[model samples]
Target: MAYLRWVLGRLTAAALTMTGVSVLIFAAVRAMPGRYSDLVLGPLATTADKAEAARRFGLGGSLPEQYGHWLLNAVQGDFGISMASRTPVSAEFAARLPVTLTLTGLALALTVLVGIPLGVYTGTRGKGGGRTGRLLGSLGLSVPEFVLGSLVVFLFTRYSLGLTVGEYVPWSQDPVRSALSLLLPACVLAVFCVAAVARTTRDAVLGVLVEPHIAAAVARGASVAFIVRHHVLRNASIPVLTLTATLSAYLLGGAVIVERLFNAPGLGSFLVDGLDRRDYAVVQTGVLLAAAVFITTNLLIDLVCGLVDPRISALAGKARS
Candidate 1:
């Protein structure tokens, strides 16, 4: 019952967060300098033409009214038509979202797999792996995603390791090629996240290590592995989980940058295209979906952290009481 209550509270918070995000995105979209009307009708279009275009595109009402209308339709799965492509935004995103998700998922998996172990090693007083992890983490943190991407492009182009140029194969038809294609871009996307995750994990572990319980475990002759598995990980999880949530948000932006750099057919490039064209439907849908995704990911991570330590659920129960 406590677990149920905890989940319900998280769900409620997520819903409110999504509502606030929708409002911000709506206002920002409307505030951008130009509109679908300006793009579709051209400069020669008169004020009447522009107003009619706005009306046709469902941009006709006051800010609150427009938001209400958009939200209503969006809830029903009617995510407006694209000003640039003249297609339903949902349909367009449906095809591209998986690509971005897959790429980002790969990047995140690599990050966690590499980061946590390195952090554990360092925090546990391992000398060699810890030194290498710290040095690489520092360099990774210092480099920008675009710069890493450009470096990959230059190196690959100059070296020509037999891979096709400008090829982006989808995983549906050919998983191997798709994985190969996504590898470099995924590395670029993961670079900063890996460093950040490693640093955060190391700090969390180190913080837990100084606690009295950790000392008790050590004094009790617990193996390093046993102590880490039983004490350090569980105690350090909240911070690591929080960092993962933040990293997911960072990954969304990095995905967009790397997709453009690699010319990958993902929502990042799709969203960028919409921005370049000033396509209200496309950009709004993209931002709102990304926000929804980020919120949902955080909720799941919170659930995991809560599960790892039921005291967290107890805290939620206390709040309700």
Candidate 2:
């Protein structure tokens, strides 16, 4: 019953968060300098053309009314047509979302697979690994996504790697080729993910190692591997889980920069394209979708964390009371 209540509360919170995000995005889209009409119709367009274009866009009413209309249509899955592409915004995003998802998924998988173990190992090794981890973490954190991407491009091009070029390949046509092409970009995206997770995991693990129970186990002559497997990892994971959830937001932003740098046909590039062309429908929809994704992801992470640690549930229960 407690868990059920917790889930319901989280769901409610998610809905409200998304509603607020929609309002903010709506306002932001409206606040941009150039009119959608001006972009669609050329600069030479007359006032009559602009007025007609604005009417067609449902920009006929006050700000609140415009937002309400857009929100109503949006809830009904109607994002309207893109001014630049003349195609339905939904169709355009549906085509591009998968590419971004795949890229982010690949990067996240690598981060978890590589970062957690590295952190665990460093945590176990005491001072030496801690120092090394800190050094590497700093290096990883220092390099921004685009800079790393540019470096990758330079190295690959200068050395004639012949593995990838600045173009996207459809997975349907060549799955292996597509995967290979995205590898470098995914790696670039994963840099911060890896650094963040690894550092957090190291800290979490080290903290767990020093806990009274962990000290008791050590005093009892428990094997290092046994202690780590049975206790340390289970306890250390709570903070690491939180870090992973937080970094997921960064991953979304990084995907945009990396996609543009790599010329990948992902939603990131789609959003950039929409912004460049002043495609209001496309840009607003993309931002809202990204916001939705972040909210949903954080909600799931919260649920998982609650499942993994009873203390979180206890804290929530106490807070509610």
Which whole-number lDDT from 0 to 100 does residue 190 have in model 2? 94
TM-score of decoy 1: 0.92
Per-residue lDDT tens digits of candidate 1, residues 224-249?
88999989998887888888888887
Best by the lDDT measure: 2
Give lDDT for model 1. Answer: 0.85
Quickly count the clashes in candidate 2: 0
Q: TM-score per candidate, in order?
A: 0.92, 0.95
Model 2: per-residue Cα lDDT at residue 191: 88
Candidate 2 local lDDT, 1-321, one digit each (tens): 777788889999999999999999988887888877767898899999888877876677798998898899999999978888778999998888778877888899999999999999999998999999999899988988878899898998789777675777888889778788888899999988898888999999999888899989999999999999999998998888888877777777778888988889888878887887778788889999888878988899899998998778778877897
Off by over 4 Å in 1: 1-3, 46-52, 126-133, 162-165, 319-321
lDDT of each: 0.85, 0.86
**lDDT accuracy of residue 4 in candidate 1:** 95
Decoy 2 TM-score against native: 0.95
Lowest summed lDDT across 10 adjacent residues in model 2 is found at: 160-169
